[model samples]
Target: MRARPGALQVGSFRGVPIRVHVSLLVALPLLALSFGGALQQAAETADVPPGALSGHPWAWGLAVAVGLFLSVLLHEMAHTLYALRHGGEVHGITLMIVGGVSELAEVPKRPRDEAVMALVGPLTSLGLAAFLGALTWLVHGLGMFQVQFALFTLAMLNAVLGGFNLLPAFPMDGGRIVRAALTPRLGLLRATRVAAGLGRMFAVLFGVWGLVTLNPFTLVVAFFVLMGAEGESRQVRMKALLERVNVEALMTPRMVGVDLDLSMQDAHWALRHEHVSMLPVTSAGRPVGRVTWAAAQAVPEAQRGGYVVRDAMEDGVVADLREDGWAALRRMAEARVPMAAVVDEEGLLAGTLDWNDIQRGMARAEEAERQRSGPGWPRERTA
Candidate 1:
């Protein structure tokens, strides 16, 4: 999970870290309102004393909200455990209002692997539903109607959650299963297109249904579904381009370090000629800062010829020699830096991994993928 500023790290489960997303704060109260209403209605139906609803309906609402998300956490864990066993690395899991997400470094390598991982989440939900159903039954027989009502509500919620997630939409388990089954025959991009297309269709249908029924919850879910499916398609395409690449292959070994005496005009020429936005500034082979276009332009144009690159540069771009290129892209994208100073184990400047480098690598990989394919089929990773 990508931890934003102020995000709380709860703990780790079997080395898979879990964190609470900020949105969970908003989701909790909303869930409390919805579930609280249901609980109050159940009390009225069961003819429980008015005190149950009147005394502490908020408490009941809070319990349902917390309990509901606990089940969602388990659903994500099932995916985390299964993914780790299948040549994938678990970055972490995150709990949010909509549900949980299992952050994996890579997609599964095989169709069977994808199918298994996708199927496990829904199966976990169904299993929980069955257990809770049994508990609800036992409590009912013991004349603990209040406990039974709570248990029954949870059981039904799980059943609904499991069923709802089974909708064949991209970014959902059933959609993944559909893509997995299709990947063997159709190429990956084609299969992905089919799945994503179906997902968008369903999203529209779900949105329309939500509107017709005046259910804002369903409409919100449909919006996420649509965005999720669209986002996953882009993710797959980017992964395809990045999968075969290593950072070392893309890094420029010649570090163009501009000294403190190198004029801003000289540095500007270097930046333009090299097609790079930033260059490492060094003094006597020791690092000082980085000369960025923004930084260089900040210097008065009239005095640019006199001002040195060091006068305008700033620091903080760094990457390791053997880091995965995709990982590097993510780090760079997050930092919003155009280039990184590639460093060796001893912390010496080794090379530079720049945005231009990534684009070139992506272009080469995409070209190679195209060249290796025949006329009818899309380019694919060879089996």
Candidate 2:
């Protein structure tokens, strides 16, 4: 639910990267086993020979798993493309078995826009269901019922996907719609709490149901839902506090700067000496660009002297001291910059806001909030 680490990029969609976590591979065996059984039933109905699937279940199972993940990808892209059309910036999409999440740069401030974006994924799933249903009918009509197993399974799954995602759980499209719908009446924080609360309630039911039926998959989904619900609520509360804070307060008091004419070795020394991932490039006491660890390391040691700081630096976001802390953080994340040059009223560099600064500032704020409110993790309530 929160941004996952090291999600491998599979490909790109409309210029947005589509990625999958290594954990997503966990579902393959489960779905393959499940699909293999479904394929057996379909084989019986179609009067197909047992030898068709008996030869290699591995091939069949993996094929279905990949197919299902593709469906999930398209479902998420529906959300991403819709958001883009309505002025949202898409970072990428990541597919985990729980579902696919589109990493969008902006969270829409409007309830109607949120609802529209939230509902689009399910709508897209439903569309896929209908299209697949028609295709299945045609295939079956053509007496290719054996071939319809994967198609039929996908159709059923998409139908279920559309229905399941509409359950109104936090971080899920349905829960977002609930929060958006209730924001005007109950207010943002209260609405998120209510939606997330409902999600926890659903999670409990799912967990109980899983135990009763001895279903591990249901329990896994419930675990993610519960974790995601709490995470969403916590993030919303943090952002609310972040809006009141200034970028200046969350920045390093002193940061190293590299001269534009400095060689790659000089830039590397500045980064190492300051214990920073990046160094601000300065020319005539004015900021030019920034050289990050990744860029510096890319320069061959043999030719290090030939490359100047300017050669390795890239343009980066500059944070205004007076800007909201979270807004600046968001800008930095969107740009994928390792650091931000925090500037004062006169646009002179005052300090630097890097990953470490953001982490420390947020941790301190959360600590203060916990001490003031009496530390307690939100517990799921029994309905």
Candidate 3:
């Protein structure tokens, strides 16, 4: 599980790196304060002796906040461990302000396998709640009121976490479960559409409820769910469209290349005159990297004459001419680049591909699909 940009790597477990998102910094203290105040009130109601707990209520609240996140980590770990056991690869787990995400490198192809994988996370959380609840009984017997109270609070929170995750929300385990359940009857694409639609419906309901209750966290969660559902739906549709397409079919052939030693001023002129947004930078007649028009504009006018294409070029994705479009798109996504350089068998540049190519390909594919397939298939979104 690899963390995305803007997250801090805190530690690793069983070979999986754990990352904390920046938003957690803002959310943690607020959670601590809320939990602390609740704990104080509960303690007073229970008539616990003053000597029973020694620290400030906020200190204990902070401990509960940490414990809650740890439970979330365990919940994600359950998913990772199960996936690894069943021959699936996990990128890593990321802990964000809302909850945790277990990034599986590739989703399991089998519906049964996926359903079980999705079910295990919430099951693990519920199990944690049960174990903690039992531990609280032991603490109460030993007359450790503080320990008992903390354990009880954590148990209730774990129960809530487990229950909340069981709701059908796309890209969440519950939504995955729903998709898996429908895949046998509807096929993967249709099952994904149905599941994602249900998730969006749930998101709408949550958003309305949040507005009615004036809960900002609920509103944020609703927005997250809505975006996740829409994103998954688009990804599945794109994967279907590009699965059989190849790089050669979509790439711009006979594209021009710029020399690495070309002055930035000249490169900028070529970019404008050639009507291209980016150019492949070549070294010794071989594609090395790429420079964008934006990169050219970053250099000051006075320095453009002194700087070379090599000075502004960044790493470019290279794709094989025969590579399937889906795989090439995955590479581009991972590289965080909008375009890729395509090479033939002899390792010579054949062409270049960018978002324009993808958009055109998608349009053609959708047209072809409409002619051959039945109605109700998801339509491609405009680029």
Candidate 4:
């Protein structure tokens, strides 16, 4: 699946970009409201003097919200730093409504390393919680009731974050830990299936509980957990299927092209005759961009004859034929393009690769593996 252009890049941590999604922005106010209300009630229960706060809960709530965001960032940073120290590359950290995600370039090869990497994030949060708890005690001794309460709230929140992440659910820190533990005995793919199955079960339970309790937040979390588990399973499967494959082996070998100077009407006709949705637009028989049937049809039927294929075509991802198949697929996914224009060493148009080509390649790989290993190979099982 291609990446969408929604995340806003705030800055870089070391060399990795830090991004915030618009969903986080929407979540902030809600978080503030919830935190603020809780603080008011806690303040009352503690029998604190009215002058201690002397104001509405919004201020403290907003402060806590901001603090929570920072705490989540720190949690993700711990994961990123550990991954980096272990010779893994991080793409970036993205803060979303659910939490922060440290995008590792690839999973660690060693199970022990992966387990430790997963363990670090929750440990960091728990450590922060403990540290804040001590700081809150010191502030309380200093007679700063408001500051102490905020610190105490943050301490509790960090503690909750740590504990919640430790639950065994796929794509979560805990899920990764479980997968790592099972990897040696079950193999990576099989372990992931086991972990992912557990995650799905957890998701369904969460969803049922949310429905009974009438909690929208729990429902949202359940939905994400389910989706994340399925996504992770598919990714690991794709990786295993594409192992030892190159773009040359997976990509379509036939070079389908539409001349850059060809009219959109002609391009449409070519698309119809070739029975292909997309065709690379070539200038001097070299791919410049790609035109799709949809792009051609976007132009009015009468006006299409006046516009050239170059005018209708959009710049697309260009994959090197010699690169790894998975690498090329990643490039296409990042670009969010339907198909990629493949090129040779001399920059000559080679062929194309789309979802169909990748699916075909994976199917072939699966069949070959089945033939070698006999029926019921790579069965889903636990350690």
Over 288-362, each residue of candidate 2 has an lDDT whose tens digit, in order, gives 678888888898878878898887789977888889888987887777776888777766667888878877888
Off by over 4 Å in 3: 1-6, 13-17, 40-54, 85-87, 261-266, 275-277, 283-285, 293-312, 378-383
Candidate lDDT values, in order: 0.77, 0.80, 0.83, 0.83
CA RMSD per model (angstroms): 5.8, 4.6, 4.0, 3.9
Error of 4 at 15 (Å): 3.9
Q: Model 3: per-residue lDDT, tens digit, 1-383?
A: 12477788888878877888887777789778877777757665444555577888889888878888888899899999999899887767888777888877767889999999999999988998899988886676577787777778778878988888888768678888998888887877888888899889988988999999997778877887888899888887888788878989988884558888999998899889879889888776567899999999999988999999988999999988898888888778766788898888877788888889988988887888888766855543322
Which pairs of residues collide in candidate 1? none
Residue-wise C-alpha lDDT for candidate 1, range 1-383, written one tens digit per residue:
24444447799888977888887888788878876777657666544545544346667888888988888888889999888776677777888767777877667778889888989999999988999988876766565767876787778778877887777778678888888888888757677877888789888988999999997777877787788789888777776667568777788885557776899988887878877677887766655668887777777778889887766788656777777787777676555566777777766777888877888888887777677775643466433
Compose the digit string of candidate 4's lDDT tens values, residues 1-383: 33225789899888988999887898788878877777767675444555588567877788878888899999999999998887888888888887788877788888899999999999999999999988887776576887777778789879988997888878688999999998988889988988899889989998999999997767877887898889899999998777657788888875658999989999999999989998888887678888998998799999988999877888888888878778887777765677888888888888888889999888887887888888778554444
- Model 3 weakest 10-residue run by lDDT: 374-383
lDDT accuracy of residue 355 in candidate 3: 83
Please report how far candidate 2 places residue 187 from its true position, in Å.
2.0
| TM-score list, all predictions | 0.73, 0.82, 0.85, 0.81
Which pairs, if any, clash in model 4?
none
The numbered model that scores best in TM-score is 3
Can you tell me which runs of candidate 4 are displaced by over 4 Å? 1-6, 44-51, 85-87, 244-250, 259-277, 281-324, 343-348, 364-375, 379-383
Whole-model lDDT, candidate 1? 0.77
Identify the superior model by lDDT, candidate 3 or candidate 4. Answer: 4
